[model samples]
Target: MKKELSAIDAKYEAQKIAFGPMYFQAVVALRELGILQFISNNRKGVSIETIIEKTEVSEYGVTLLLEAAEVLGVVEIEDEIVKITKVGFFLLKDEMTRVNINFMNDVCYLGAKSMTESIKNGKPEGLKVLGDWPTIYEGLSILPEPAKTSWFEFDHYYSDNAFPEALKIVFRKNPKMIFDVGGNTGKWSFACCKHDPNVNIKILDLPVQLKVAKANATERDLLDRIDFHPINLLDRSQEIPQGADVIWMSQFLDCFSKEQIIQILENACNASSENTTLYILEPFFDNQDYPAAHHSLVATSLYFTIMANGNSKMYRVEVMKDLAREAGFEIVETYPLIGDSYHTILECRKRA
Candidate 1:
């Protein structure tokens, strides 16, 4: 929303966007090849000859990537000597940055090429790059190599940190049974079980996800208190079973289009009693205080377009509230900025 760019600066920025892919790959190569780390270690700056000698990459490869990195502001070069910039330091060490770059490199990089096709067809046309599946969720468990590792790391990084704080809110009412809707891998379910020994978790998700979740539960010796009800939440014929004091969906609803979200929430309401409290944990862009955090959420929208459902995007807070209202739920309380994480928990109750 900042619209004060000078004409020349705007033109230069446009070119940056045009060559963004090249810049991104260069940075990734530098990181993977240890060239970035090498430069980082030599704070006084390393010579091009030293980088070429110390790393497996050729002199030509090192110089080209370093040149691109310099333009990208990831490194600074003076008198043919290279040193890691502040940005380079983050690229090397920041946990969130590491996850984001890995996800882009492993999961989204190939699929991004089909974005226009995906937009035109309203399907994940790019998903074919990894394997065949309706959406990324269905194929997550079987994703080959670094894709599987990077995908789970990316997905879990955002929601896992918020789990501990969410547990406190969920346990306050002393609920015995909580339904984990779209509970991928039963991570949140495990957290709930550990928080209160008596609480039971019934996870409702795709059969594929439940398979992994159930296995994880069994491995942790928590399956006795946890159960699974496999259902394609998108199917109108399927509804979550009744009898629970809490229904929770963390980082889940944003995976669906607004229309789908309404249906999903309506179904959640159908399974709820007058006393049931529905909790939705999402990192709504509007709720983020920093521009970079907001930027990351919006960028994730393209992943949905090209690789995920191809219909949903990271949503604004007001838009989600509207969807929840139409679904016959009202937000009674909100827990924002939970535990140094960008996630916000919407504590909702069924409207009379």
Candidate 2:
């Protein structure tokens, strides 16, 4: 039932795959040299000679990079003048593209070389490029400068913009105490305290991350409203604290395997009273409406396998719902793809 590709089309596809790395590096070079921005500003196209004059790189390097970018549809050349194409404009200016590019180049590209071995070994073999930690989260605070910046930028770009919208939903019931599980960097906890003067937050996370989160919260004088509970979620014996009105996990569970997630959810249940509500925010790959969004999530799963954690991924919504059900929770409401954000918030409660 599949349509066969024409010989020419097949060859084109094959060449794209074979030359992907070269094309990616060419775009990186073009962007790095300021050539893309230069051509973009020109609009009417600028002479290749002018680009060579403007950048420190050799004329040979400029020509080669631009020519390759042309083939990649990132630029165009006519009458000795080069112009930034639509693709090039996105590459240069789009926030999503910029984050993705930096994340790929600085964080994942080199590490991805060990992906095959990581898959075969069921471990983060590629993570050796970053550190010796079993997972990326443990080494997050110490990852080399720009790579660390790129990694957090990529992570926050997807999660932070959705906070205001999510806050409205989270605080709809006027919960007095919110237990923010896997509360990295304290961004959510800070937002919660600022949202409601009467509200307090307890952040549960690794000691290293909690230290940074506490410092960030303290800098804003939010430490009084925020509490830190340093505990490893992997320690099956350690449990989430009780007496919270709402339990929150935002962009967190994807960092864990299914079994670990189930255990965590069960711990949440143990910490929850019958009246307590649990909120889970995640970007489920299959729940994405846009092909581009789905593509990015699928690619992110590979990052989990090769560098983040050997067992986690951007999961399907149904799979997560099933796990929650297995852990004695029932979905009371579902907010899918909230406000231009690729995240879903599942409002769940302990099943009676």
Candidate 3:
């Protein structure tokens, strides 16, 4: 898989990698200082003088960022006038891009600096930046301000859009009981309650997260239909509750190491009847058609390595398929691109 690049372009790309962090900060500075917004506001290119004056940024700051932006292709400059480029527009207006940027800036930026140490130690060394937690999930309920919001927004944006289609697939067989492993915020369970009046969802997650989900269910008057089961997936002694028509794990398994994934799946299998179906919804990086989506997943895999958990990652479709198979389940069906989302849902059942 050789990349096609001219000698000059190859050297330039190497330089871009060398100054990657600095360039990232330049983008942040431009966005935060309102330079990008100001230029975008005025469709016609604005003079350097106008940018400094209108953005209220110091001339030194304005000139420095503008020059960097020009080279970064975030903006184009001609005759001392600065204008937003297509890349800049996406930075400013694309929901996915904005969410990724904010998530990185607020939750991952500082911590990401410690990724090397995290890899070396086989632990989330970066977790210290947020708090003294063993994993990010432990502190989700108590994360300070923007970090908490950024984490959930990043989490939901990837999976929630696939909920409608996921609902159709899960309830099609008229499942009466669903076990939502890692049912953060009880979102999928709430969706299930609404979709099938009689369906009961038993949420399996940490107590801290379940507290928030339980509160949400109570507020929605669906508490009666959803039950909370506090069990840490890392604790192998805890058995998943039995008698489920369907076992649902959405964007969940990627949070654990391969060995841990198999352990958890064993728990699910022990709890499941032969007729039960297991639905796993994950956005496998290599399974995607779009390069952007693939890149995002790879970046997220690094985030998991440095921030979420040390050994987990956004596994490839084949990797997950292998994990499922190793755990005594076969992927019976696959529903891809659910609702035009990046996710691929694997419908599994016990191997015969």
Candidate 4:
């Protein structure tokens, strides 16, 4: 009798394993409901008849889709009336919306469909899907109106949170001058001036982003204290203004390869004096073999590589120290700040 019971359990497990394909069908059904809310604004919950009339799909197909969405808890349906759930409504809200959904639908979703091929080939197919556009920024430039806006809005949201925390970690003491390398929109520099009334801030970035940053600084009453410098990081021969006590490189290094990073560091070293501090802040990935590092590191690294053409692989603290040493400075200290993110404040003293 016990043996027969064990066989029944094994059959149940097999059935459960066979249900894996249902997962993607469920995702598609939920996406349909999200689209419905996006279109209708969730005013009167979209019924099967309404969906059939509005979408390319038929009434029978609408019913099947709604049934799947109901199981996924994206919507509630009773007496042939359908309504978006709280979860569904929140998902449609401005802050919480899946703004990337359209981008996914147009570009990434198709690439995801070929994820199996990517795994087999050991290289992503996304770049090929975005042919002739050498970078993600270049590809985004060609996208139609709302898609480009949505992508940048998402970028702004992340920078908004990251810049403030990075400022706190780096600008603990008020300094006379700060050089904000690659400072987009002057958010970090503005925050610094607001925190320390006596501090003067300089922002360096592309002319386009700097124009926006200048406008923001003017609006914030920081135009006098904050200055914008349009400079390319690749061009090292251009003179970097001297005598800045703090040089900030926030979320900038990951955009370059190690060799390029070394070149940038070398230039920065030449610009600094004995009392200068170089503050580098980025999302840290522990490169050690220890199982103790946070699980988010792996996911963060892969997403940057595939989507943004970034490499977030962990670099040893010793490597940074060695770079500083080669550049004719001694690393005074390193500090971690604000959650698990590593904000290395490397204070380098110029060799006499």
Estimate the Cα RMSD of every predicted model relative to the unseen true structure.
Answer: 1.1, 1.2, 1.2, 7.3
* Clash totals, every prediction: 0, 0, 0, 0
- Candidate 4, 1-352: lDDT as tens digits: 5555588889977875576346335545556544445334645665566666766666776777677657656678877778877655654553624543444444444445444554455444454555444335435545455545765664555345555556665666667899999787576787788778889989987676787788888888788899888886766775567788988877666656566677777777788887788876654455323333334344333434544444334455566667667766676666554433333445555555
Candidate 4 global TM-score: 0.63
C-alpha lDDT score of every prediction, in listed order: 0.92, 0.91, 0.91, 0.62
Q: Which predicted model would earn the best lDDT?
A: 1
Worst 10 residues of 1 by lDDT: 186-195
Q: What is the C-alpha RMSD, rounded to one decimal, of candidate 2?
A: 1.2
Q: Which digits, one per residue and each the tens of the lDDT, describe model 1 over residues 1-352? A: 8889999999999999999998999998898899999999999999999999999799889989999998989999999899898999999999999999999899999999999999999998889999999898899889999999999999999998898888998899999999999988888998888889999999999999999999999899997899899999899999889998999999999999999999999998888899999999999998998998898899999999999878999998888988999999999998988987889999999999
Question: Ten-residue segment with the worst summed lDDT in candidate 4?
Answer: 287-296
* Pairs with steric clashes in candidate 1: none
Give candidate 2 regions above 4 Å deviation.
1-4
TM-score: the better of candidates 1 and 4: 1
* Residue runs of model 4 more than 4 Å from their true location after superposition: 1-32, 35-147, 156-159, 162-165, 287-331, 337-352
Candidate 1 structure lDDT:
0.92
